[model samples]
Target: MASRGFIELLRLADMARARKNGRQGGQESDWQGIVFEIGGQRLVAPMGEVSEVLTMPEYTSMPLVQPWMLGIANIRGRLLPLTDLSQFLHVPSRLSQMSQRKVIVIDHDSVFSGILVDQVLGIEHFNRSQYRSEAIDSKSPFAPYNHGKFFKDEQDWFVFMPSLLAQDSRYIDAAI
Candidate 1:
């Protein structure tokens, strides 16, 4: 009887370990996406796809590129197209007159694009259930890029999903 009880305890311990691993691996629905700062506003993106955050650098400008396209910057020898999040998201760029901006380079199914941001706040994980899909403002051109509304403390923020922007043909066809 004693041996049987010990085996049962070990099984319980193994089960607990598996559950912990699953939670850390983000296999649960409660996992909130990662959040970063851009233009003094908090934006959230799915944690699984964020490649890296980089500081502003010189990028080759494309002729006749769309207004939102900032240019292409070489990152670690790889030239990546950088789009200004301020213009893409339709937010004011000169709000604080940023001197040291950053880029959040994202890779979607092998396609890469560097998203320009004012600054990076950091990474954070929150439950997806906590996010509410707010109605898009009709007047804003960037409504399609917004995922929904989220709150951090008493301040409400808009969440921009980069995948939606990446899928847009304008971003893909732009030349540098």
Candidate 2:
């Protein structure tokens, strides 16, 4: 009876360990994103893509550049190129004052760019199952850069693929 009880105890411990591991694995599979607004549209990007968020900074205007190229701003002694994300995405530009603008800095690979946005909504956590790989309208300007979308609070949060945006020729071509 003593040996049987010891075996039962070991089995219980094993079960408990398995349950703990399962919960941790489930949590690891969850997706997280930072929500932000651009051109009055709600969008979300993977949190890992965003390096920093800051208020609009004074930037020097560049000559012979597209309207979407806002110019370069000195960020902590680093010259960061600022892009009007709304204009680049072919959306209506928000007419908010400079003080109300927000910049989302993306530092990936050799590219470092600050995306001007309307506001930073905050971080949102969602499960992998919550994502839907639906087709975006071909005519939509965001169609090429959209990864997927998630729904929350009766609103759809479109996932904007920053990496793709970084690689796009249009984004790379700052000079006219």
Q: What C-alpha lDDT values do all the predictions have?
A: 0.65, 0.77
Candidate 2 Cα lDDT to native:
0.77
Q: Largest lDDT belongs to which candidate? A: 2
Residue runs of model 2 more than 4 Å from their true location after superposition:
1-29
Question: Candidate 2, TM-score vs. the true structure?
Answer: 0.79
The digit string of per-residue lDDT tens for model 1 on 2-52 reads 313322343345456657867443244544444656655666776555666
Which has the greatest TM-score?
2
Clash pairs (backbone) in predicted model 2? none
Where's the lowest-lDDT run of ten residues in candidate 1? Answer: 1-10
Candidate 1 segments exceeding 4 Å error: 1-29, 32-34, 37-40, 95-99
For each candidate in turn, the TM-score is 0.68, 0.79
Question: Model 2, range 1-176, lDDT digits (tens) per residue?
Answer: 33133223433454566568674322343776767887777788887787777778899999999999989999778899999888888787576586787787888898899898888766666777778887467787888878879876676788987888999998999899
